[model samples]
Target: MASKFQGFPGMDDILPGEIEKWQWVEERARAFFEAGGFKEIRTPILEPTELFVRSIGQSSDIVHKEMFSFKDRGERDMTMRPEMTASVARAVIERGLLTQAKSLRLYYVGPMFRAERPQAGRKRQFHQIGAEIINENEASDFDAIALVHGLLHYTGLKEFSLNLNDLGDEESRKKVKTALADYFEKEKNRLCKDCRWRLEKNVLRIFDCKIAECQPVIEKAPWEQFAPLGANFRKLTAKLADYGIPCKVNRRLVRGLDYYNGVVFEITASGLGAQNAVAGGGRYDNLYQDLGGAAVPCTGFSIGFERLLTAIQAQDEKAFEEIRTRRVYLAPLEDCAAVLNVVRETALRLREKGFRIEMSPGVFSLSQHLKKADKLGARYALIAGLDEVSRGKLVVKDLAKREQAEIEPEKITACFEQ
Candidate 1:
């Protein structure tokens, strides 16, 4: 039965069993980022609305249509972050991290808010695992791409495709925008109302349109003639090939955000239908300057944590078996005070030694404890009863093997170690 009162519509509670999967990925991501000279950064979820307005562009969908914005008690306009890049730039500049480091390699893991019509693998409040290389050269675009590639690969995704594109520098993008406006304008009658509005607003946004009616006019647009994947990108692809990183050029891969300039790319994994892109990003060299900072060359990418996990689960059935079955179920076989004390002490000690212990709040019968342990897929049950506690010993039962052994109080950790 559903609860009479439920959580707000796009928010979800990441309950216990499922939350372990999230933790595993988060741990792996932290290790990988730290190893690559990246440090973690956390910023508040709320920021001044103008931060996004200035950085993501006034014409972008995130600013105009999707942002969750409101005026605060003091009448200051604030917004729940719709994306991280703008917020990151705000943080790096505000905190003087800019002066502290010549080049900053930073990573973030957290939730982002966007008002979107929800669908499979897409959420209104979705989480992201992303990294940025600030003040690095153009080659850092490739570095950011390769980092995400290696990250997804590390998470055990065997089959995924990389689609690359070059949005060019500021000077080239204006030319592309003008050419796109002229071409999209000729076919204005064929465009959806949004595309027509976008044509005058930000012509590049037309490529982001998903309406079935606009495909014909958009497909024939002269993207290459106006903004061809330039020679510099040719060198990037060749370098990728030299290192055996597979990629294919996609002229239409211009990303949604407006601050993006220079190279842009998207990575797609199979099993996700139309929304197959699991991760995407590119260079946005001007974003810092847009948010009241010095000109900082930067490249970064963000992976949809939900979408990437779904892709991994679709291909592997036993995806989180190890995380599931490794916990020790602490069983107070008898509800006596002494037995409870022994079980509590043992649980704390095991947890201190880095073992996950599952201890129920209420006491259960011996048979009930065993059943609960099996139901949770617990590998072992640490049993303490009046008799065992009186003898200063405990019974460790291997739930899977149907085996039991007696160990002294001091030897319980060693028993589980075996």
Candidate 2:
């Protein structure tokens, strides 16, 4: 009665009933990326352990606490990729893709592993749809942000806000980091344990701490004094405004990653509560050189696939209805070989016409098959019985209309073409 095994905690299985939403989101993402001239790139799920440490920063949460790292048979350190930017950089450099083009526009859809406490939108193994634009300038930063805005809009997410921040250039970041470190050190006792540890190692990460005790100290940190807004940052905001994309400038928004510099952004949707960030990313100019490639400027963003679906479902229930309709159910009444062939061929032809077809197995009775079709939300059911097979005809029943008609095998697909 009880199962012998269970899935790992925080690792969820996307069951059949729920996976349609995922597919819908993924399809829209792929089409959007392709239209924007971003070629798809898939990197290995695992990378050298040092890659993350070097790119994501050792003091960051992903590298310090959340990474799934271990050694292999040869005792070489390896890690399951917690995020994709590092892996994408490694691929471009290793494959010499950058050598062939002046710039690279690539997108990826896959799972990222992070050993985080699972909540509604967070998971140990989660999927992301992201893109990277390498060897581009500050204008490309605007492009990257706008692209994410457009994609989220395409998903039919209505109530969302785009919060933008500039981490400043490298020199400004160094000054701010030092200022934050010194300021947080004085208030170290008042900070959380994690913030206390980050105070010395990577002080910017303290802003990422969501602990209530640390919020007061983080809010008072001297961000404007050290990293004052620059001209380019103003221009980015102006451009976004010009395009009619509403955004709020958040000086405290230093994204969790250390590699991000210049511009950073996060898009949060309403109704998802505290973990409402559906998408976020910014510029990482030095990542290429840091990972053993030529100096290149890159900007990109990743949409949390699960969170996007949640927001869509909450806002628009009808979005899922489109995928539920136009499905065909095939019911084979006779268990004989000839009837099976006819059922199989008919289903195959219908599928070729771009219809979702579900075939009933041999053991199901005609009544049971009809029940299954209804359960699947199919609009039409094609019943193939001995009499219909002998007459080279199949019974097409419009489940929604409660009507049935005998049509020749060739006319079966034509019945639903309208």
Candidate 3:
């Protein structure tokens, strides 16, 4: 078997050194979500097939094309979640989280699998950070948008704009979608094959088509003209403006997911070719009740983590510093076993004190250890040998400045404070 330990096709690993940027973004997300009163929630990655089909709609692209479906040992059909909202809805209702609370605001961050093409950011198993606010006023929709805006701004994501549009309330959208059916009925040859199939199933997807030829046709289409804004929808948009967030009214902004019922919006950053939607979400006013739970209004958004990260890098190549695990390394002379043990113990103590420590695995020459420390990007190298160990002292050298100092071993912690 040719040493088959390769990663699954279309999936890749998050290598160790590349995690600093992810850590920074995740920390900011945790802080922002906490400040907004949205507690964290984790649901199982595997969900029943019916959960998605019932909520995301069978005709939608996610359900029809991208879902990773399989059968369990008991022969029950199951699917790895392609998106989080439906699973969150099912979990919320099944766990009865909504029964006791007047409102539930939850945020989730985890992997979602979809069998899509391997592109710059669209992976088969990619991660997403999302939030959901259920059982609240329509105002919560704007609040969700504001929260997303705050994260983007806080993370230094510039050169982006939020496209806001209401799918209209469920009833209003039905009226508009029904009214436009005949208008596009005879234009089958004019639209792309995907748009043609979607015309009857999800007319909104035609507007979101990425095909260059289909773009002009959808652009000229009259769908936006017919989608009217109701009072609730107008108030939501107004509230977003009052918060100092600039939003453009894009009538053609229909998300591919079926669960998005009321307001649908997406954030796009310029220069992210083909996969430009950095984040998106919408109001699923009836999704909770439709999934056999109490009627609750909910709205949320998700950051396409990989896509957004790529966009940031493309715009600013030097944004991320080189990855290094250690800020300091301790080197002990090759012949000094006892001194090596003391140095190792000191390194462990520094780590427990929240300092990043690095060292050679076994004893090595002083020159070799210093070379390794420099390569590993260690700023300070602490040296201890037979002489220092006997005296209970250490020789600290600054790699950048080529400066050295003799310090008592007990006072090593002071170096970090300085």
**What lDDT would each prediction earn against the true structure?**
0.87, 0.89, 0.81
Total clashes in model 1, counting residue pairs 3 or more apart in sequence or in different chains: 0
Clashing residue pairs in candidate 2 are none
> Candidate 2, residues 1-418: lDDT per residue as tens digits?
9999999888999997787678777887898999999999999998999999999999999999999999999999999999999999999999999889999999999999999998888999999999999999988988999999999999778889999888988888888888878898889899988888888789888888999998998899877888888899899899889999999989889888889999999999986888999999999999989988899999999999888888987887786776655588988888898888888888888877756787655657778988999998888888988988998989998888899999987777877887
Model 2: CA > 4 A from native: 333-354, 363-366, 384-396, 403-418
Highest lDDT model number:
2
TM-score of 2: 0.91
Q: Cα RMSDs of all predictions?
A: 2.5, 2.6, 3.4
For model 3, how does the per-residue alpha-carbon lDDT over 158-271 read when each residue is reduced to its tens digit? 778999877777777888777667666766678888888889787776776788777766776676577767777788778878878888988788888877877888999966
Could you estimate the TM-score for every candidate? 0.92, 0.91, 0.86
Give the C-alpha lDDT of model 2.
0.89
- Tens-digit lDDT track for model 1 on 30-95? 989999989999989999999999888887888879989999999999999998988889999999
- Answer with 2 or 3, whichever has the higher lDDT: 2
In model 3, which range of ten residues has the least summed lDDT?
318-327
